[model samples]
Target: EKADGIFILGQNPGTNHPRMLTTLERAKENGAKIVALNPMPESGLMHVVNPNPQEYDNILTYPVKMLLNRGTALNDLWLPVRINGDMPALRGIMKEMLAEEERSPGSVFDREFIERQTVGFEAFVEHLRATDWEDILTGSGLTRDQIRAGAQIAMHCKRIICCWAMGLTQHKNAVATIQEVMNFLLLGGHIGRPGAGPCPVRGHSNVQGDRTMGICEHMSDAFMEKLGREFNFAPPKEHGTDTVETIKHMADGRIRFFLGLGGNFLAAAPDTEYTARALQSCRLTAHVSTKLNRSHLVTGEIALILPCLGRSEIDRQESGEQFVTVEDSMGIINPSRGHLEPASKHLRSEPAIVAGLAKATLANRTTVDWNDLIANYDRIRDHIERVVPGFENFNARVRGEIFYLPNAARDKRQFNNVEGKAKFVISEMDLHKLEPGQYLMMTVRSHDQFNTTIYGLNDRYRGIYNGRRVVFMNPEDVKDAGLEQGQFVDLTSCYREEERVARHFMVAPFNIPRGCTATYFPEANVLVPINSTADRSNTPTSKSVVIRVRPSTRTAEAVNELRRNIDEVRSESASSRSPTRQS
Candidate 1:
């Protein structure tokens, strides 16, 4: 239960979770070893200034920059694994650990826990023993000694927490890679203990909650039965469309109506050009949002922008003012009350909009009281309590500051699997196959932006200023590709005999692994193939794209020609409209 070691993989908590820096700082001060594994070095993991002055400063100051530079050191070891090489790197570490265990026999691994709390240990061990070292070294861009060093850390630590994010999940072998991570944990008996488990940091808030509340296209029969019983309606048993499927359906003219409750789907989705075309193919599209985004600009034939109340704005219903409950990553539900006034008087809450739309669409066909549900939020909560598991007494429990939804795996070492114990999954090592002139490119968010919203042009953490259309490549790769820093190049992705090109992006030499490059999206989303997605998850393979970087050729000339044609057309129109000129 002791938190002696913390391993972060593929996440930059410094920029993403800036507030958690202080917690990490304290954890480090308490002698916790922090190891960060990523393809590119993140500033947050390198160093972070404690925002709270009481921890470092004696006097309180406004603006906070005066005391911003003082904070705790982060990341005792930073492993620059190749893009999509997390599976191999982790396997390498486990291999080294197994080697150590073979030498000393029960010194490195918890054999007792393996026998009691786990199944398939013998098979997993045999697989690990049979794995070739050469393949591991090649898949991971690390030497044997580097992998050994990481293995030594895992072997010595009593408690270890493995954290990862989209970097490890947006690949073809994403599920397998994560299962490998779990295999590593289960081997060392790292899960179900204090300060030791898997922590998958989601990009946004309430993502896990959304899934728990049956927001996914795929719902279990049990959930559907409960929903039908509560609502007195027969729910559809067929599977629904996911993001990729939705795009495909739209492109094929199968889907006509597209309604987005929230999120900038166009900017956040992959294959930007294709996704845009799919959206335009729809007969009608509606978006409920607080502010305008890129998705509003790219629309279908009939588009409606339904401005909704923000989380910070008061929601006045027929009963009285109401509050919405949001669940965090940790399954903790909390009531979110808005103290500020609405941005606009015409804006409606999300619930109100949905209810109104349902009433208009259904007319008198359904027995559901849409207007009554909107009258008071408690009615909605009561309905959710009856339908959704772990949400019993949802209205009453949410009145408190926080309530934790029951998590069997988190609360106890309970795993509802085939063997009733944690299973050791065997996964194949499938790395990206790159050609001579191609590099593996991964899309990342800039420090200046949150997801697709750009707050500023500067990526202050990476020292990039005044731009977002810049690719970060290894210096050696830049030289090998015959490109210089600040040079404009076109990034072209070739997949399934189709090539998509993003034009005129500046190349910046960075400390990434050889043959691997990183670029910020949705600027580079055009290079991602719509068909290239993770198996099972169906998430776009944003972290593993084979792309060729070439110098820009005829794009400038094409733009100049188009501008000249526009000017000539304008001149001709003016001449035709002149008073002295007659037709």
Candidate 2:
């Protein structure tokens, strides 16, 4: 399990995970080659200072500290990939690797491993071999030499880790692109090995845990049967609505009640204006939250705000005190305890609120003991242990530092596919084609924001100050469009014969690829259509949007008025300076 090379795809660790920079720095010092493939250059990947105080003191002057603590350069090679070009770039690398395998048979690929543990390898290889170089170059915005350099690194490394995030997953070809990445790793027998695998970094903490705890609408029949057996009641096996379906239902006036646990749905969801209208169409909307957000302000006919205790606040019940178990990205179950007292006496824990709602709604229809579960969290864990697999002795196992959930692929090198082996998937090369005068746009978060929360207006890492209503564009593209720095423009997105506009945003020149632009959302969420989603995943295609920029009408009118006022002042000054003989 020795890893000598690491490839980061579509993630900006600097702003997203500041603490991970130190880990990357250490990896680089240990003779590991780090390659960063992103659309924009990130500060965290460029250079990172060790945050540990023992490594360097923080009391020194800024310049002195910089010299004394010369940080580690995280990225050895940075590939500025075009927006939504992840699939093409991965295909290009795989194509190069296939060529090398052809030249030196069995040197670049694992023939024995493919034959023994994988299926459909021949078809996958054929697809890569037949990939067009012209499409690769155009879609990836990289030359043949660049792709070859990346393949060479992969060929030389005995073990490698491929990491990706939302950047590659928020597109129409999101699922297909990820399969391509896995195919690249499997070409050299990277699966079921130490330090060699695919790592899809989760955007938020406990997201995987939420899915594991049956938070999704599409739960498997096995899980539902287990849950029904454990709870002594028949559970619904029908698939529930996803985000897109929920929005559509809400818009059609079918969904009467809307309940949100802990999210700024209005700001986070795509097609902000449409989502807002849909929410307004609901009969009643309710939210369980710690603080007020934009969703709270935009409500339905009858709205209710249920104040809940924050994760950091003490959750006290009739029994005494309690703690919640949350699973991390790597399947590590850890108990999270809050040291601080509750912010308000009226605030209730999430579980208590849900239990109260269920007890009131169900009345005497169900046999489930909501009161008992709310009194002690151990009872909930016990039920979970009985219902969910790999969670045996949940209460006892979650007490120590951490406990890992069972992962067959990682532990036993066993694939849980239909054929009981890893399957090599073949996907089509689908690239988003843009029309003339339209640029590929994507929504991004500013440095001062986390998800939908806005802490400040400035993004210091990207050199953006005093603004969130600004679009980042390539300098050459900006100049070619006859636009100047700080010029105001209106962005309009056309999808399914419908147009959505976000007005009056200033342009900032950046180092992004040509015909691509980036803007911060939920401001830009207005431009995203609710209908535009990924094929299989049904995820919002927020990362690859086609939008046109036009000069702002208000800015143009203001400029004209200012020029007329300046001329009037000039004429007045000339008249005042005239001689007495002329008068």
Candidate 3:
């Protein structure tokens, strides 16, 4: 896919995908163009070898050489759209592209690609045609013109890659939002081909791998039957539990054993107070992680913290230097072997740990060779191959260079849907709102943090330093409440009758959007209500919450004294300003 230009939109590669820098650099060296559409600035991706925009702000940067350092691009624009507003902004431009396509038949819509490859496109196109631009602009919080410019670039580009992370996926309508994104890319025929597609930047290295390797509560029938035949063991047929359901079951005392493979469960789950209680109530709590985290401290009466070999650590077994298979972003499966020795002699691999526990607890485990299964990871791969699709020859394919899973990017002619058509679900925007004087509070990860780990106190990207327990608010909101920046505030959520109340978090204020404020996750997770989640996915909408802010006073007398002094001062000022006081 030779092209005159390259566009990277709605993704931050420097912090999230650092390895992509090589491809980006090579593309620049070859005189191919690059365009970035994002809100943040001054990252490795923005400053490629050839300086594109030496002195550029809010607009297009055409021909990189003259503007900055020795660069070769003609023009690139950094279109900054509002937060949680990508859906409407993208849809508006899609409308314009449709209009252009209609004007000139068989132009660049990739008619052959759509007709031969995709299904249910007519229904999708109908939905797009019916979408009102005014409603889109209002919901997206972007001007029609700005979105139109982005659309134009997408339509014109030959090879384009659109990527997004939690910023786009952790929303109430995230599924639909991402679906629309795919729709836009597919409309331009940019996906399923080399050098072009939709990429969801997963947070963890093996999150997708875990899902592919049968780590889900909801297992397909085909996969289950394959597992029964291949392993000769009857796996639990009924769906078990997801993160949310697991919490509910634990709280209700139905699930006594909480066995986590490798995750900061307490820190990752929603509603910190209830999650802590649920974890504490478990009869046997087990955490398999490389390092000790907050979950170890928030353990039950009988708890086991089993350390494990990190991805970078050597997985020594009878079979010599062992490697674990991890599926990275873009569906490429590679064997990840630890180069360093184990942190502790007591450490074990995740699969080994799971097998050991299962053997110890289950009586029917006599039929399975848990030790052999653990010693040779290929056995695990064989089981995976038999159980999961796209892994027909898991051992052979895995032994080679990283290979992609089937039906994810390629084989677009048929979809997983029974009708072989990608369904376009109809949805209406229902933005969360709070009462007057209440602002929408969202949780975000600091630049210095990874998942729940606090690497440092400074968030250089957001202009914060030496502090991780601070909140960002609009300057006007601070002034309206008689508060100043850097002032301490108590964040509180509303109570519903006899239901459990959320914890109040103490935070310092900084400058952000007027009606929108943000706090770091886990610490800020206490503010997120448990029932408040997305419609379809049931994913906790950790990004958005409605809360009230009160001035945090260390002493009750201090608050009382301030109130008393203010009342006295108001009385005196009124007496002086007016004819007389009401004494």
Candidate 4:
């Protein structure tokens, strides 16, 4: 709310985080210019009401004032950039900023901050200056004038908070695109301030928290040393396999055992059919989960569906009822207390499951007392406090009313580099180049879905209702492709000459870029190639997949497949059967 300007890109906070609309409402009321950069004009960014406050089950019980709340108008400007065009869009903005800086000198650029707090400023400026406006125009699908208007809006604001999600992360040039955003922020010194700096939003708070708790492929040396000191044993320095590498190994028969802690791994992973085959190749597959999903249906030779207590379920431990601490996207550590009793009494907590797995795997050779750790969860927090930095007095501090974890980038504008100063990274604008008849297809969640979980079939913003298998394309693109409104089309993506097809997606004429289209996932996940991933992160490039859309060549197999999955999930939900291990 303290920010003068807010730049939202990639993520849809309105649908994904509806409660955030309330915060945006506060910011707008207090005078904040919210700019939305997206391929599709998201209703969440444009106009939205805080539905969380109006969680009344019955319309009859709702008050007049609450019922009439039309909601707040959010975006000052909406930039409909093409899919994978965020890099060029950012570059265009930075180029315009540099021009403005050159024309007015210090009035537009923060010279003192740039000199004192940053390096590579000169090179970054040079890169932006030399960037072709033509390339920016073609790549971003926005004119030079439009780009300048955006820069003009940004130049006036003192504090800017650039927020993004998976839409920005799941790309080939994902890291570079974020660096461009940072470069823009660094130009005006937006770091280390309230309502300013980068905000990478996650669907789940514990996704980021998992990284803090050392559930990563590559743990930092500092974290390893801290663990060694606390546990009296040196943790492995060698990096473990990431999701992509693990799947690759499994497909190649290198990895035999697949044990998932939580989440629909098969559905969430890229190349749906490939991932299924990979799991089938495995000798054993186990998932500690709260509900049954498609993952259970497609398993290895021996599969175990070990039921675990969800975050909303009360975890009665050996000592007492337990709550898990999760770190939000903004680095706020909060204790999550469960309000509901466990659906099944036999279901174990995540900690208990982990401890059991550890005991079974390591036997008597384990260093830490697994039983004691599981008995009192606070003991685990004690271990966490000892190991993780900025977590000093973890149990005491987290139990308080407010606990904000210290962030180096946000707290002091401190960069963890050789020079200990933030470096301005300059990279080439790598836009998605689609061949003729090929549209850059990006997957998105409907208003009714979260990640891989489908809530409903309607996406009111796009005007599609009671339908999950549909593609949103620009009206011009639809006409150009010889596809009419409501036409059933198949999408084909040929990666390394190996073609993958997603059959029968209805055409949804939306306000998207001319050559770009949007489809829902795990429906479109079949088109996402396993090998094509982000440059540095190795994360699947789920956002950008080059595919050609044509009239459906086959039956409604793909669409029917989704319906079957939904029916299966709903059937599983209705059943009283507790998930169990099966050989």
Candidate 5:
């Protein structure tokens, strides 16, 4: 809300993050310029409403507040860049800004900040100058004028914030693309300033918290040293397996026991069939969950569904009703106090379950007492304070209304590097070329769903109602492919000569770029190749899948099966509507 300008890229804060719209709306009202750069035009950026009634608490006053907070326009500029074209677009903007600085020195670039707090400026300028505009223009699928417009916005604003999400990640050069974003911000010295920084909107709640508690494939050496000193045991020097690595290990029969804390492993993971096979290979697969989902259906030889308390359900531990602390996306720790009663007395908390498992597996191998740790939730915070930096007096300070964790780059404007300064990155733009019948397919979550949990079949953001098995494509692309609206089609992805098919996706023409299509995830996760992943992160490239869209080739038996289902539903509906129907 305090920023002079906001650049939102590769994320739809409206449907995915509706809470952010109020801030954007407030920023707009404050006369802040907002720029949206994404493959699809978002409704939230264009139009947003603050649902919170400021003064209207009752029926009479509610109308007054509603009438006052009608709506707000959130975007002053929008650039519709194609998928995987973010690198070129970002580079193009930087190139324009560099030229602007040359045209009128001292008015554009932050020379003092670049000279003192940053390094590699001269090399970065030379690289930018040596770059060809043809590649930037072609790869970005944008015109020079459009690119210059975005540059103009950056040039005018002193304090700017750049925000991005999964759209920038999940590619071959995900890390490089992010570096490009950092480089862009560094030019204007956006970091370590109020209302100015790189905001990476997390995909799920408490994921940042998970990383803070040392739940990562590769733990930092500093964290490992602290944990070792605290526990009186040397932590493993070798790095553990990530999601993709775990899947591969499971498939190789190296990992027999599989346990999932949360999330639908089969549905959310890339290559649905491969992931299912990997899960099936496991001897025992246990999941700590609140409710049943698709993962429960696709179980291993011996599956265990250990039902646990939901976030809202009260956790009555041995130490009385306990409240667990969770870290938000902003790195602020807050207590989660559940008010609702437990659904069942047998249900246990996630911490308790993990504690029990630890006690059983490592009986006397360690000196740590699992029971004592799980007794009171405050004890966990105490331990975290001792080990994790910036968490001193966690139990006392966490009770406050607002608390922000320490960030060196954002707080002190200090860069902890070999050179003791931030360096500008030079990233290459590698655009994915399409074949004759190929389209760049990316999976997206609908408004009605949170990850794999579907609340309804409708996606109100895209005007999709009562159905999820539909693809959002350009109308021109549909016509070019000789396919009409509402036509059923099958999406097939071929990697390393191995093909995977997702059947019967209805075409829904939308405002998307040519040669690019968007499909709802879990339904389209099958098309994401396991072999195709982001470079450094080793994360599955879900946002950059190459696929061929062809007419739905349903067998006669499959057509008969569909007819049977429809007939069964119609008959049930007719029977319920009969006059003799009992209440």
Candidate 6:
């Protein structure tokens, strides 16, 4: 219930969430207690209900005074943990809480509920009992006191909801980290109740729904069997491709064609240079989008940019009017109809575009009615129901404003682990490498940006304006480096990987940890190497990057001044460190 109260607002609804804006608003207005857990505050919903309560307690944290008052005391406890250390800190808290519950056998640990609803509590308990707080704190980069406090707050709360985004998932240990968060919630019996759950705020309007409606690379045996029975054809039983695998195949000259429903695949992917090269190698790269983006421009030898209808744009089909279905972060399926006219008349709906592509690609096939599926979306839902379990009434139940699905946590069902019970994953403090003058830089989104697009140059939450190329550092680090505010510096990484290279980056001083630094992603992504990814999950390790900052010999403005003053004298006379320096 505590984690559920965290709305994670100011995030771009179009890019990050397709249907979460309204639900977020309703949750806030209904006294659910809002905690805008983000670095930048630019979402329109972050209006002033109260002007002043207290000053910003932490330099890195957004001001919580607006949400905190005499009644909403929970808002005052809005703690800003480290950017990428979310899992370690959260898991550490869970471990501590479980230990406390064990000591007090008569404590409110909800063992009865765990036995009935969960499948793997014994192994999970054992893992928690074996976990050491020192490892958790060191891995998370938090003190023991901090973790205990966070755990105490969660335990005391009647309802708790843990909300997280790419910060938690885009790492090597993303799966394990997420599982730990689930374990934390389950330990306190927070699941299957109002105002609390594990909310994975998805990107795109229906990215989760797309996976629900057969967009997954991994097709389970049972799902495949059902699909085969429905279509009366032997559908490919082999696992297809995930986001990373798809790119790998494209890079290896194996995948001849690329088809994206509505994502800026190039911009959203890790290792920009490699992903771009892969796209260039493809025989046919295609995108069905509502707007033109960098991904469309980075095309193959033969590329196609098929414009599609936006969610807010009108959908005029053979049935006269049309609506699209989108699932919110809370698993609620809602209908979205575009009231405004299309940006272009030639644009087609995503479903229509998919149907057309299928018909064109499989012209010789006579199994499925491609055109009929495009006419009514109910047919698509019907096919989804036949294939994907837990979507039994995909056509009927989706008619409501907000309808939930049968998630194991939400439905109070058994845990989906190997042991038929939830497992408390213990993360050991494994230091890859760290040297003197090396700072851990985390990739973050700016208030002016949405995913990969630069909308403007301002971060209201961070209290910055007119720049997306600035890095945030601790005041102490800035002083120690002999660097002041608005100083230009070279941000270099310590790794030498396939796609990892240290380059110059501008620096701006702000409140962060002594050894920690923060930089905007995609722009600052060049500093992070492709090989420096999280464990098992293979997601880019954007959260943790060791960087060295050096005072730049030249400022961005002094380039022209230096160019003008350097006459013909230095052209012929070169010294020892003159024209070239190689490391």
lDDT of 5 by residue, 1-583 (tens): 6789899988889877888888887788887899898888878778776677762346565565467855677898888888888899989999999998999997788888888899888998898998799999878888999999999999999889988888888888899999999999999988888989988888555345887889998999999999999988999999989999899999999999899997778888999999999999999999988766679877779999988887778888778999888776778778887777777788888899999998899889988888898889888888899899879999899788758889989999888899888899887789777889888888887776666766666677789875677888999999999999988888898676989998877899999889888998878999988888899899898889888899887646445644564565355445434332111
**Candidate 1 global CA lDDT score:** 0.83
Model 1: weakest 10-residue lDDT segment is: 574-583
User: RMSD, model 3, all Cα superposed?
Assistant: 11.5
On a 0 to 100 scale, what is the lDDT of residue 273 in model 1? 94
Q: lDDT tens string, model 6, 1-583? A: 1343453421333235434444544455565654443332233334422223233345333344433521122232333445555656766777777777878863746777677666567777776667677666655666787667766766665566666777666656667767777777776677777667667766655465766667778767777788889988888757887767778789899998998877678877866777898899999999887666679888888999887777777788875777777776566778877787776678788888878877887887747898787777778778878777767777677775467777775676556767655554555434334577878777777654556655555666677665556678878888888888877677777676332543334567775656778777776777666566767666777777777888777675544433432332133123212222100
The lDDT values for all models are 0.83, 0.83, 0.67, 0.84, 0.84, 0.65
Error of 2 at 582 (Å): 75
lDDT of 3 by residue, 130-204 (tens): 988777776665677777777677677776667677666666778777877777767767766666767677866
TM-score for each candidate, following the candidate numbering: 0.92, 0.92, 0.83, 0.94, 0.93, 0.81
Clashing pairs in 2: 1-194
Off by over 4 Å in 5: 55-70, 555-583
Per-residue CA lDDT of model 4 for 1-583, tens digit only, reads: 6899999889888667776887887899899998888988888888866555455456554454358856679989888888878888888988888877888899888888899889999988888889988899988998777788789888999999999998899998999899888998999998887778898887576365888888899988988888888987878878999999999999999999999887889999999999999999999999988777789888899999998887777778889988888888888888987777777788888889999999999887768899999998999999888888878998888788768888887887788889989899989888667789988888988776666777666678668876678898899989888889877888898677889998778888999988888889887898899999999999899998888898986556756766775676555434423333210
Candidate 4 weakest lDDT stretch, 10 residues = 574-583
Prediction-by-prediction clash tally:
0, 1, 9, 0, 0, 17
Q: Write the per-residue lDDT of candidate 1 for residues 270-382, one digit (tens) a residue.
A: 99999999999999999988766779988899999998887777889889999888876567788877777775688899889999998999888789999899999999999
- Root mean square deviation (Cα) for candidate 1: 7.2
Query: Which of candidates 4 and 6 reaches a greater lDDT?
Result: 4
- Model 4, residue 89: distance off in Å is 1.5
Off by over 4 Å in 1: 54-68, 206-208, 554-583
Candidate with the larger TM-score of 1 and 3? 1
